[model samples]
Every structure is written in C-alpha cells, then in structure tokens.
Target: MADALTYGLGPDWEPGEDGLPFRRAARVVVLDDDDRLLLVRGHDAGEVTRSWWFTVGGGLDAGEDVRDGATREVFEETGLVVRPADLVGPVLTRSAVFDFARVTCRQDEEFFLARVPSGHDFSHDGWTDLERDVLDEMRWWDVDELAAAVAEGTVVYPETLPELVRALLDGWDGTTPHLDESSVLGPST
Candidate 1:
C-alpha cells in the first residue's frame, strides 16, 4: 500500500499581486442514508485549526479534472466510490479560517455532491491506507446530531451540502422523512 502521507497539494501557495484570497481548490461531498452526511477527520498543522470536520477530499492534482479528484479522494478517505451528481452545480465558496492565533487563511473551495450507495460499508475490505486512518469512525448521523454539531460549531459542512441533502430527499421515495428543517432540510438560504 502507498503511504497516505505521500499526498500532494499540487499547487504552491503564492501571493496574488494584490494580496487577495487564494484558491484552495475543489472538493466533494458524499451524502449517505438518513440524511446523514459523511465527514472526514484530519489533523491541521495550524494552531487555531488543530482539527477539521469536513468532507473527504483534497487539492486537485495538477491538470487533473475535478470529478476525477473527487472520486479518487472519496475512495482514498472512506473506501466509498462515488460518481459526481448534480446538486448546487459548481459552487465557489470563499471562507476564512484562523490557521494559527496570528495566521489567517482565506480559502476558495469548489464543492460537488456524490451519492453513496445504500448499505455501503466504509470499513469494507477495500479501504486504502489514508482512508483507514483518517476515517477512524463512520456513522449515519441523525439530523439533530448534525444540527447540534453545527450549532455548537463543531462540524463545518460545505456551502452546497444542504442542496445535496435536498436533492437526496427529492429522489428518495422511501418511507421515512429523515431530513427536515433545522438541519439538512428546512430552508435553503
């Protein structure tokens, strides 16, 4: 198996002529059953950003397509293979994070949604090196759990995440209505 630490950032951090926000590249979100969202846990070297609760993805390789990167990262981080589906289109989300007490980072992230097959086991026999380590735990979280996490400021969902939830709800003809307001459901703002 290849070392997970061998991952690359692809592009170097270069200051723009005007010193504006730099693009952090794109990512993918894989939505599972029960309106539960899939998040990958990882360590951040920055002080204020010691840990991150976000989707499973990484910087796009040089000249690599976004879709390919999304698919590769998902499989690498969770052993869950997925194909990109429509949700909020290609959304460019610009946000700031305090990496350290003094260092600030503005990230421009591109977001996409992918559907995880029902009954897909992330701990299946096909997990990659990084997937096994980064995703030590995986569960189908309830809407309330997600809401609480968001409210308490624990997890950070991508900007297009809600839209993906809505899309899933719309396509799901199943019995239970797992997503509603105050969480992945409710309003799209």
Candidate 2:
C-alpha cells in the first residue's frame, strides 16, 4: 500500500489509515464592512481539547457546484444569506489529509471571500447536531488579533489566512489566485 498522508500539529499527528476517502470541501472568508473577518472555533469531531478556528465551510454534497457549496455552507454555519456570484474566490485551493471524529480523509478545499454588513446576527438554527457539538464559538477578528492568536499557539486553518486578509484589506483586486502550497498549510506530499 502507499504511504498515508498526515496533517495537523506536533508529535501526536499521524497519517491516515488505508483506504480513507477523499472529500472536496468549500470554505468562505466572510468579512464585514469594518474589515474584520469572521471565524468559527471548533474541536475536531470526538475531541474537545484540540479546538481550532476556521472559516465557515464544509464538504460539498454530491452534485453541488463549488460556489453553491460555499454559499450553502456559509448560510448553514452563520445564518447569513449570500448570492453565489457575490463570493469572490477560489482564492486558494489546498489539499490535506487529517482525522476528524476519528475518521481519516484527504480533503481538497477551495476558499472564497465575501462581505456582509457589520454586526450581522449569528444564529445556530441551521447547524447540524454534529456542528453544534463541535463548534464552540464564533467571532470577528482583526488582523492584529489573528496574529496574536497565532503567536499564542492557537491553530488556525489555511495557516496563511491572516496574511491573505491583510492583502485584501490592502486593496487586493477581486481576482482569485491559486495559493501555492508553501503559502498555506497542507500535507507535504
């Protein structure tokens, strides 16, 4: 059999077992008019202490387009409705293999950007039971706060997120760039 892929941090991180499936997922980087980015804090399924902050998103259901999946994910996780055309990316595409809820899978992800009015209400009425169990909190963070969190050992997915947000804040054109692996976090292979 081929070598399994590995992800996450530290010595405890391990490779996936044989025959794990691959999943295609979409993520949204929701920003408010104030330039603060929205994030959700959650633990990996079946684990409590290993929480991390990630953008709003999840695996696409069968037959769903990437943009459609992203829009649906954002609404489900944040209760904010947005048009698929309003989302501004596939800003970054990445692949990683990791375990969530003790199930190992390789995930291909596309990240998109969107904006909403400041102080939009975050409602959990749409969250799945699984999401409710794993998700701990949601917050809007400035770049400085995100940098501080990284410095303080908080794990944030797409590791280059803060820099990306800063670029957007610094007048990035709406074009989406395919992020290099070196620019984000993912399996070495």
Candidate 2: segments with Cα more than 4 A from true spot: 1-18, 171-189
Please give the TM-score that candidate 1 achieves against the real structure.
Answer: 0.59
lDDT of 1 at 140: 58
Residue pairs that clash (backbone atoms under 3 angstroms), model 2: none
lDDT of candidate 1 at residue 43, scale 0 to 100 = 44
Best by TM-score: 2
Error of 2 at 92 (Å): 0.8
Task: Give one digit per residue, the lDDT tens place, for model 2 in 1-189.
Answer: 222223222221233343554557798889999999999988875465677888898877777899998999899888999889998867778766655655555667888889899989898888876677778899999888998989898888777789888887755576776654432322221
Report the lDDT tens digits of candidate 1 across residue range 1-189: 222222221242334333422334456656665556776555433232344456666655557677776676667656775665543335334343324222233344555656555677664354444334444455555546665666766545453344445555445433322221222221010
RMSD of 2: 6.2
| Model 1: per-residue Cα lDDT at residue 96 | 36
Deviation from native of the Cα of residue 155 in model 2, angstroms: 0.7
